[model samples]
Target chain A: MTDTTTLSVEELTQIVTRIFSQNGLSALQAEAVAAVIVAGERDACKSHGIYRIEGCLQTVRAGKVAPQAEPELIDDGSALLRVDAKGAFSPAAFAIGAPVLAQRAKDQGIAALAINSCTHFSALWPEVEALTGMGLAALAMCPSYSTVAPAGGTQPLLGTNPLAFGWPRPDHPPYVFDFATSVAARGEIELHRRAGKPIPEGWAIGPDGTPTTDPEDALAGAMLTFGGHKGSAISTMIELLAGAMIGDLTSPEALDYLGTTSLSPHHGELVIAFSPEKFAAGRGGDPFSRAELLFSAILGQGARLPSQRRFSARETSLRSGIRLSAAEMAMLNEFLAAA
Target chain B: MTDTTTLSVEELTQIVTRIFSQNGLSALQAEAVAAVIVAGERDACKSHGIYRIEGCLQTVRAGKVAPQAEPELIDDGSALLRVDAKGAFSPAAFAIGAPVLAQRAKDQGIAALAINSCTHFSALWPEVEALTGMGLAALAMCPSYSTVAPAGGTQPLLGTNPLAFGWPRPDHPPYVFDFATSVAARGEIELHRRAGKPIPEGWAIGPDGTPTTDPEDALAGAMLTFGGHKGSAISTMIELLAGAMIGDLTSPEALDYLGTTSLSPHHGELVIAFSPEKFAAGRGGDPFSRAELLFSAILGQGARLPSQRRFSARETSLRSGIRLSAAEMAMLNEFLAAA
Candidate 1:
């Protein structure tokens, strides 16, 4: 087996930032994008961390993604905000957009940030988690080219559209979850395929509309919508809410924009934030205290919150170091040499 | 087998409205609530139709629900509105809240209506469907007393929260979906139990947390979260969104308020409406035209939209009349006689 490399967050961020700078991003833009990936690394979410650096590098190299474009903001009203990402690196746009969303939600009761023309290339949790840190409830949904079929159908007509949510949890880390509407995210199937592992039965169907345990067939064909039709409906809603509502390409439209009929799904994202204190009736005390009642109930049942694992992993990695595969380390060295 | 009774929409509405009126609801309140049940009846959604009429009757009789109370609205700003349901039937509150939400969304870009003190006892689709009829998109979520077990735990701690969403579809009836975050609604299990049918595996666990196909055990024990952990996480988010964030009772609190544990869930709901015309860019035309791109894509794949079945069922029922069993007809007669 290849050796694993231990890298501190500071070390990885510097190297990744330098590589992004060499690949046409401004220093600030590079740092912003690198910070997102590094945070994912610190949480040990490989699909979003160093594992995705190559994808980001390729998109930047092809001139398909703008590295230094300034995102445009449309000030609609006190609670309404719109943004045009202008083909920029998605994280860079969000870096400019998230704080504005949180502040507006704070000043007003609720706020919506509609982001268009973004080439979203990171996990959705960071933006939402940022909002939660500011004591705001945050929601983010994004659409991509189709890779999931509506339940009861054989064709892939919906993106594995992801939805992320974040809420404050009193003294603990903010409660957060970022998940794809698909039964399983595509990266997972690829991981299973790479590991030569048989996939679970309910995870996906082959092109012939039959159950398949082969990860390769599952990925090449389509993943099942989570919980059948309900998940499919949720994905369709995301296609409308995050895609059409935000004035960006829907899943199919993303294919046309990307010049691909059936390959990768890439498109825009939408985020909304709500201020907790503004709308509370105090019927059940403060929001967090009321939340504690449910939290205690959940814990009493020996069930863990969805965000606990990621938050725990992040804490451990930050205290010690993030782990990277030997291949990932080599790839970083190659990028450093090229830079 | 007992004979089936076919009742016209008008006949059913009259019967249901009369029963509510005799049960202390005003003519307007009775009509509003009956209209929702009749719509469910027209869609052949028996679970939300006559089956739930008794729940409404009992809650009103128990004096926990105000059948004739007027819902109050607090206008927070251009985009935010808070509503007090006055402990009224959810449909009546929505009858008062939906139009105002739609109007505000039309005037502003987006709007939210936080409904508090509601005794929601019907399908959430009608409220969102009303928004869709006005050429808008809408979302609604409501919490109930705990019935679903969190993913890794034996004890039930979260409500089988139902989330409903709607999107306007040009000339056709709007696309709409209302789904519980649980594997199967408890009402379904009760129906299976009544019919002497076996509940599906993976549908629920006995109180012991081991899988059981006995519908009775499933109902008495706990419902499984749909798609395992992800669905549980969604239910948790709903608890925050519809429960704590709105300053209403969360699942446990709802149980405490109701003075029962593991009984029927009763709690509040939250609704949001979005005006489609407000945010569209001319990149691929208006939002509706852009949405047409997705609608065409879905239909082209020989797949149906999520709301197709309900919409089509409603049309068929409208033409052929709704079907009810002998028992159901007798129950309606008894209610009419009592009224």
Candidate 2:
């Protein structure tokens, strides 16, 4: 059997933070970034876990991100909060704005946060979950680099924009879901290409604008939006709301500025928070208890909640530590040495 | 060609308003309901047009709706606005609250409106469009009676929940999209059954939890969500935010209370409005012009925007009055004669 190393969540977070700090990130940036990456690993979401460290490092090395920049919160005392990342990693920006956002939601019953000029590479779940942890319902979305096409179109005009939402639950993990609007994420297509496998039909189109299953062809062309036109419309909305409306880069503009998809895309993100207590006030039922009934009915029908797998994995990780393969360990050591 | 009738938009509205007024709806409710129905017919959305009138009458006759109940707006001057429909049709409630919601959005950068205890039967596009007309971006959602199964399960535990979004445009019709989050709308399946045809595979499952294509079997069973798990997650978010969080009926709860789907379901709605001007306050570009570039790029790629068909139909209806087929004309006359 291959060798493996088990590490506690705290241990892993420490190592990750050191790597970022050693490479040039400020303490705040390193710690905030490390938390999300470690959370990803703890939840068994390997895609967003340690595997993303190299991308973060690459982005830093290319001088694309301000490693030491401190995100500034521009709160005008309205229902909207703006965080200027000043071209830094998104996690730090989000970290600085989330608490204020939650407080504003409580005060106003609804609030929105706009994080601008950041290189965003993390899943939105962590941000939404933060609000949920604060006893609020949250929605988050952002536009990535252009790689997905609108439905019935061949060119990459829209990003594989991800939309995430979370609802607080008492004495249980919150209801959370984060997903790319693409039929399949670009990373999934890349994996198929690396494995010499054909992608499923409808995932992408050839450069010539025809349906394509060949992974290489899809990589050269564009990914399709999920649910066809409905998904495309949603992706477009994300571009308008999170990108353009926030006075940030649209997917195509980001691609043009970056020139390649290898580096993290620089853009803005929008997160909206709603206070359930405020929304349900003077109404008949307790929102949290009513939500439980809906959840139970869903589970009773054998339908799985979106993050059940992640939540369960989290439970195991908390109890038994995180297990990393020998290859992963070697990669981490090499990164540390380089730093 | 069959004999048909053509009527100006105002004429149709008058007729529809008269029918509702005659059927016991208060003038406030009657006029608001007529406006939406006329708008739907003008836009060629027959599914939500005059066809919905019979359902409304059925609900009124069954004493399930308070026809003369006046909607009350409860605003605490925060970002959230509430409209209690008092068991009347939803349009009047929305009409009463929309202006305040728009003003709040403008002042606070973002705001939400919750309409409770309403009999909702109209498509969400009209409400979203109203906000867009006021130069605000809007999102609206609500639960219907349970008719669709959550992804990965067989039983119907979720509604074919409708999600609608709108973004303002400077010199054009606003970008708007409204769709049911199901593989196929329940009405489509009913139509197939009436026509003795089969539904496409993946649209639904039979009562035994097996995939089915027979229209009859599918109607007796449960419908599937669009885009599989992703769409299911969005539908669930609607249930949490618009239903339970707002202290209104969830899909199953609505079904349980109504005991049938033939009448308009009594539930609540959530509409959030965002001010692009407030959001793009100090950003580099104008949100509206930037949006135009994105829209141009999408159309440049040969892909169509979401409401192109509806917009074009609306133009035709405006230039030359709305055209109704003989059958539709006969139906309207029959209702008028009865009244």
Candidate 3:
């Protein structure tokens, strides 16, 4: 086994930023994107971390992803806005659009935004946490190309569409919950396949609609819905809410015929932000004071935030530095050398 | 075995509405609530249907829930508003709130409202469908009293919270998805027990922290999160977003321990309404034109809307009436007689 190497967070972030800038991204955009990617790696989310760097570069090189493209405001109002991402990276879209939504929500007490034509590339926690930190509750959903099946169906007709929600806590890190509505994410299967381990039964089904332990066959078939019917139902809703509503390519059929140019994993994201202070009834001031009171009461016995695990992971990384296996580091080096 | 009685949709809806009205609900609110409950029953969702009528009436008769209290606007802006249900029945809150959110969204292009202090009742689809019928895309979530455990824990600390999303389709019924974040809803377990069947092994755990096929033990112990760590994380997030953020009772710890006043099942509901016309790039044209184009492309193959099943069920109910098991009708009769 190869010994792992430790890299300071700053060092890792700087390397990723440098590589992105060298390739095609603007300095600010590169830094922002690199920060999230590095954090993912630090939190051991290899699939969304530097492991995705090569894919990002390929998209940029193929001219499908615009490194410097800015998200333009298409429509702006008090309660809602529509943004055209113009093929920008998702993190950049979040950096631009989320604040806009949060500010509107703060001003009007609630706000929502629909982001269309964006590239998918990162974990959702950072963006949600950012909103929560600003004293807003937020929920976000995104639709992607098909990788999951509807309940009882063999075909891959739905994306492993993800939904995330975040809320500001009185005396702790913002509570964050982010998850893809799939039995097993494609990345997990890939990891298991690489590690040469058998997948658990019921995680996926083969082409013939039978459960399989072999990762290869599972990939060849389709990932099952998380809780059979309930998950399939939610995934289907994500398709409609994020895909059809946001005007992004959703089902496999729409993606298959998107013309001669290769479709760049186009995704549509929806974000909502709400201010709690606006809802406090009969409270003189400090609407969140009641919130704090209620939260303390409900968490009476023992309760923790949803993102506590990831946050703890982040703390450990901050203290001891992030460690990467030789194989992962080599992957990063290969991408950087190419850049 | 008793044969199931097939009653027309109108007949069943009338029966349900009469029962609610007799139990002190306003005519409109009773009808609205009755439609949702009866539809849930027709679709075999016994948990959300008339099964809870007695519990709902118990709260209403105890003066915890208002029979005709309307949602009052707490704060209002172009895109956002805070509404206090004032201890009203939830359907009344939805009826009063959904339209306001929809109209504001239509007028300003987007709108959102936080609904708090409402009793728990009904499926979310009817409200979502109401929004979609007005030609807006909508998403809603409600956090309930704790009924689920976090992953790796033995305590029940989160509600089997349900999230719903809806979108309008071109020439098709709006696609709607509604589901709880639990492995199995308590209703399903109860159904299995009533049928004298065994529960699925992985779906729940007994009080001893071991998997049990006994529904009684599962109910006494804990409901598993839908997708292990991911689902647990989501349940936590819902508690924050819908509970703490909306200033309602969330975890068990946050509840009032003061008086013997029966605890009000306060649910915080968040609704987001989006107008496609506001976002379409076309000038002074049909707002849904672009969404229509994309949806057509998506439905090119064998893809179907998420609400197709329910819509079909609705159609069947309309054409041939609704079929109710003898036991269920007996339960409804019992509720009516008690009222």
Tell me which of candidates 1 and 2 scores higher on lDDT: 2
lDDT of 3 by residue, B1-339 (tens): 467888877788888888888888877668767877887866656566667667677777777677777667664445665667776767777776777787788776667767777776666777788898998878777766665777766666667777777777668777677778888877788888888888988777788767789988887777888877777776666665566556665655333321222343666677777776664434333535544654453355345545577778777777787777898789778877877
Cα error, candidate 2, residue B165 (Å): 0.5
**Model 3 pairs whose backbones collide:** A79-B79, A297-B253, A297-B254, A298-B253, A298-B254, A299-B254, A300-B253, B147-B158
**Candidate 2 segments whose C-alpha is farther than 4 A from its true place:** none
Residue range A1-339, candidate 3, lDDT tens digits: 558889999999988998899898977568878988997877776667787777778778878777898777754454666677788887777777777787787776677777777777677777778898888878788776666777767666777778887777667776677888887788789889999999998888787767789999888888877877667777776666566555665656345633322344766677877776654434243545544653453355355545566788888999999888898778778767887
Residue-level error in angstroms, candidate 2, position A336: 2.0
Distance (Å) between predicted and true CA of A244, model 1? 1.5
In model 3 chain B, the worst 10-residue window by lDDT is: B253-262
Question: Model 2, residue B74: displacement in angstroms?
Answer: 0.3
Worst 10 residues of 1 chain B by lDDT: B259-268
* RMSD (Å) of each candidate, 1 decimal: 2.4, 1.0, 4.3
In order of appearance, the predictions have TM-scores of 0.94, 0.99, 0.85
lDDT of 2 at A181: 96
Which portions of model 3 show Cα errors greater than 4 Å?
Answer: A1-7, A251-264, A279-306, A323-339, B1-23, B38-53, B68-71, B194-197, B251-264, B281-309, B320-339
RMSD of 2: 1.0
What TM-score applies to chain A of candidate 1?
Answer: 0.93
> Candidate 2 chain A, which ten residues in sequence have the lowest lDDT sum?
A1-10
- List model 2 lDDT by residue over B157-246, tens digit each: 899999999999988999999999998899899999999998999999999889999998898899999999999999999999999989
DockQ of 3: 0.35
Error of 2 at A216 (Å): 0.6
